[model samples]
Target: MSADKPKPAGVKIVDAAKKELMNVSAIERDGNFLVVKGKIFGTMPMTAKLSPEEARKALRMLSPGLVWFLLTFPFRRSPEPPAR
Candidate 1:
């Protein structure tokens, strides 16, 4: 019970998840957990409970630009040398 002690996680991940998810409902918060209830690949109802750290990691992984960058990185040619 100290000011320096961190408070238990709340809904911080909801926003991040929504931004990353973009197409589904992912804004439910339960205690220190984020509950994302929705369909996946139009297959079935996928309900995932994620902690704050997990959510942040997922956000990074789910980034469209990041995914494309990683996919195309190997094929991208390096820049040419500057003119003398």
Candidate 2:
């Protein structure tokens, strides 16, 4: 396989990150770069591109915030329960 192609797990890891991270819910890979895209407030478009090392660093930095968001975002109630 060409080195440019990511291993299957790379896609999975990126997918999970996109799902769990705020403002970063879509992602793709371009060679060694990870391409991330999502919306702020679920409406404003945002994007980022990261090399492999940068991607790893970003994930590490985001891990705590992701955990905290997951822990707190769902149970806390809004005036109305969220639609989804």
Best by lDDT: 1
Residue 38 lDDT (model 2): 71
The Cα local distance difference test for each model comes to 0.64, 0.63
Best candidate (score: TM-score): 2
Model 2 misplaced regions, further than 4 Å: 1-25, 56-84
lDDT of 1 by residue, 10-39 (tens): 222224334322235455889999787665
- Native-vs-model 1 lDDT? 0.64
Estimate the TM-score for candidate 1: 0.35
Displacement of residue 41 (Cα, Å) in model 2 is 1.1
TM-scores for all candidates?
0.35, 0.37
What local lDDT does model 2 show for residue 74?
70
Model 2 lDDT tens row, 1-84:
657855343212223334422455567887888788776554566777888887677667767778799789778863654487
Where model 1 places Cα greater than 4 Å from the true spot, the runs are: 1-23, 56-84
**Model 2: lDDT of residue 51:** 85
